[model samples]
Target: MKNIILTLALLIPFSGFAQEFPNLKSTRQDEDYSFLKNDTINKNWYKTMKFLPINESKSAYFSFGGDIRFQYFYAKNENWGNGDQDKDGYVLSRYLFHSDLHVGKYFRAFVQLQSSVVGGRIDPSPVDANPLEVHQAFADFNFINEKSKKLILRAGRQELSYGSQRLVALRDGPNNRQSFDGLKLMTGKENMSADFFFTHYVAARDGIFDDKSNQDRQFWGSYFVLNKVPLLKNIDVYYLGYKRAKANFDDATGKEIRHSMGTRIWGKSGNWRYDGEAVYQFGDVAEKNISAWTTSINGGYRFNSIKFHPEIGFKTELIRGDKTKDDSKLQTFNPLFPRGAYFGLASVIGPSNLIDIHPSISFEITKNIDWIIDYDMFWRYSGNDGIYAPNTSLIYPGNTTTKKKIGNQLETEIVWEPNPFLYFRLEATWFQAKDYIKASGMGKNIFFTGITTQIRF
Candidate 1:
């Protein structure tokens, strides 16, 4: 079943390609060359000869470009539980490949594949195995004005970035990108722009889960932004609304739904850059009525080859339990919402289940080199009593019983760019927790590291 699904997915893009360039005839010499050479020539020949409009200006016609990346990671103490263990030492953590293809003045496409190994296993789930997965497959369209101003209309699985702090990022599509079947419209002028987007959910893949069950999920959201305000030169403002409905096969048997609204303001003055954001969420999870809020602030300064950024953030929530006694009515708080990576080291220590305060600094070492250092502090505001709680024995704590717990994390990374088309990155981290929150089903005082290389054209 998985093989059949994979075959179908692989053929879908080819089908689209065939429809888009059906009339082109191949002039390659050998049959084998036809297959291999066809892949490269089809795109180039189509763009140059077939797609170009006669009498069109060079800039008005079509253009093509793309990028690719490869990555690997090395880690120590790889035991992520679930009946798995990692010996203390070095290990190949990941192998990743990504590519992007742009078409005409308005269309773009991208795809990513990844594989990894840990604890001597050849294929592990994203949490434990080595596998190959596609990260993106999308297209974009741009609109132009008489004066050559820029406007854009994009659809398919595409990425989005907005807000001063990315608080309501429905797509979470960067570093590890998340895309959706959606549409986006935007317009921009010198140093000013606005954008709007709508998206429907899709499955997430990262070397985990069998392909059979990897069928796409469903979700939808809308985001908007107004940036580059003149009142505060170098400043921007953003607003976003996001909604996500649980997938059909989600683990939670009860209805799982979420809605988020947020706003952000940011700007730069001379060598200083400042930003802040706030968000509110309302929804039902596992049949539990839920409400939540979050906020963050950040500032930075730049000096020639060196740059520094520092940030802080927080989250709060209200939950209502099921009505029936047997259903176990309960309200829980999740601490990791606003800043999952608050402490650089903790992000590496274990899964960011919840509860944290984070701050960090990043620097540009040179034209092609850079570094970032960050720290995280954690505590439980409310939830089940056992591991995530301290100073209280209540089996099921309410919002009132929640208290501050303690944990800290540190992280650092170095990036190297050899040229416009090539680059490398390395990272390391350490974490420490004071109570069961860090040890229960999660790691404690753990360490991790990773590396990646990329090329573009």
Candidate 2:
């Protein structure tokens, strides 16, 4: 009760300030560096702290930004699939400071430092803390500039995201989001763009300056997007490759090398929008052959003119699973570095070896407030394979009582964007355990609630 009042007190003032002070003006002519133009909620804060600018010029300029986020989470029956446990309440906070330097258009540098901490948890995990470390340190150099196209070479650690984030994502939902150490070559025109990279995932350690690239794994991929194609709205075609020295799955442990090829098509017409994606994987884990695939489709319609401006949508996914472990073939689909909140805000399940259907609706309560509700249902793709969590951990092994029903989840989220730099969100989720989870070990349903607030600058 005290936390709720304190949270409200902290958030209420930002709403008044947003109306009193418009966002600061950016010196740059283009919206590329504008603080309020990058994201849907306009939460970028790069230019908001203009009073602290070290130097400003046309050819060379330096700016800084910071973000602070706090979240309170409570979950009933925390680990339902494995066992029954309850975590009443916990608080998580993350702080980030970054510097963006640009020396003309051809050369630039970016560095970000993060400090993440968590407290009051029932069971604390490794993903919680890193006192301080460089989150992103990258140098961008453009080699070719054509009238309608440009080629840029970026080196060092950076962030990589593509498509709808069903597969590759930054994992921002966690206290310590994931980053990578890699080099990338990007080429693009006004309507087309492509990215090629070879990189390694960064491992977050508990202490400061201890984070480093994971030596056990490597990721390489090429992603291309075409926005001006005829009759295609927008198309994304990609090929991703992953290699790990050691991996275990399906009662087998060995070196794993997997490749995925996929395409995503999406667009909007009037009040209707649609997205479809499909991916196929083929590789080898030691001597075992790997064959897996996943598909996703979602569409939505919006009534912009109506009161509250509501939007309704539905989504479905099909991910392959192994039928039996008798053969030298493994069939569990792997979603590499997917978003932390893939299946709604609760994010209890990941898109691996499963089938799911989700329906959602959202509406704007005011110009600065919005609310969303969703109901998601899950099932195992192969009854013989059993259920797995988002991290590919075997929650229930194959033939776990011959139960295929995973569960159903109902979730709601409310977001308040007081201004471009300040935002608040509250989320609640109820997960009803089904045959598989209950049969395994679950004693009670799962109820989760999270309250979050962030100041981007």
Candidate 3:
């Protein structure tokens, strides 16, 4: 009650904001405001903050931008009442500011600072609180910069993402997004590109100035994307490598080394869009041979002739699980650095050792306002393997009971974006516990509601 009203009150007027006009990018580092340089007549009011001439140099300039987000969550029986019950709900606030300095066409530096805090929550997780810290600090050295192609070397702390954010993502759904400490080589053209990097994941500490790269884990990968090719356009292929000193799974916990090779293909035509991805993982864990895989299909169709222009969307995923608990082989597909909200706004479950079917419909209520309704069903891909959390944390181990059905979830959201810089969303979810959840231990259903507002500038 009061939380809902207070959440609505946080939607302040923030016309003075972040992202560039029209093509507002999710990743701030990718924003390009060079077109503002020619607007001598001050066509856009944001030019004062986005385009600043450095010592009157043609190639040297500085751009400043920031964004603040407020999120409130009201959940009953969180995680099926498994852990951390807070009937009073919780609120989260995140502030991110960044500066981009370009010395010339060949060199530049980007730095971003982040502060995230929580209120009215009992025993917050490490990801929930970060008083203040550096989120991204990197330098780009462009070896070849042209209108059609680019070759650059980037170093330092940064964010990495790939097609659809199924595997590698920025993890912006949570208060504290993910970052990496590494060096990357980027080369690409207008229609295609490739990224290669070797780095370590940053461990988020609760306090300020204490976050650092994890010493026990190492990540390396190569991702390539091709678009506008003949017959087979819009394709992504990648090979990812991971190593951790200690990895936890239902079967065992030990040092793990895994490698994943995958590809994705997607396109749209005549109000219809589709995407499909497949992955194969092979590695060794605790001297046991590892084999795992996951595949997904997503498609949507829009009714262009309808009054509301509604779109019907569907997604299905099949992630493999451990075959047997007593085998010398381990098979648990890992969702490496996936998006925080992999399946809509209610992200309680992750994409590991699970089978899911999701269907959704979204329609525009009015100008800049939209509404969405979705439902999802889940079951254990392998009854021998238990379910997992969004961060790949084991929730339950395999039990003697053969019930594999986890539950069903229904969710809805209303999104209102009156302007380019300010946005608001209200969402609710109902998760009904099933026999499998009851067989494990608890069978309490879960109810979750959230309100979110963002001011980007």
- Could you say which candidate leads in lDDT? 3
The TM-score ranking, best first, is 3, 2, 1
Which residue window of length 10 is worst by lDDT in model 3?
11-20
lDDT of 1 by residue, 85-158 (tens): 44433333333344444444555444544444444444443333435544344555656632335687766655
lDDT of 3 by residue, 1-457 (tens): 3543553455443344433366456689998877776778745546767878786654788888888888989999887888768988889898899999888789989999999889998887766788898999999999997889999999999999988888889888888888999999999989999999999999999878888999888999999999997776689999999998898888868998999999999999789999999999999889677899999999999998898999999999999999899788889988988988886556777899889999999998897899999999999999999888777788777774688998999999999987777788999999998878888767799899998988777
Off by over 4 Å in 3: 1-20, 43-45
Q: RMSDs, each prediction?
A: 11.1, 4.6, 2.4
Q: Give the TM-score of candidate 2.
A: 0.89
| Full-model lDDT, candidate 1 | 0.43
Query: Could you tally the backbone clashes for each prediction?
Result: 15, 0, 3
Q: What are the per-residue Cα lDDT tens digits for candidate 2 across 50-77?
A: 3222345345666666677888888877
How do the predictions measure up, each by TM-score?
A: 0.61, 0.89, 0.95
Which one wins by lDDT: 1 or 2? 2
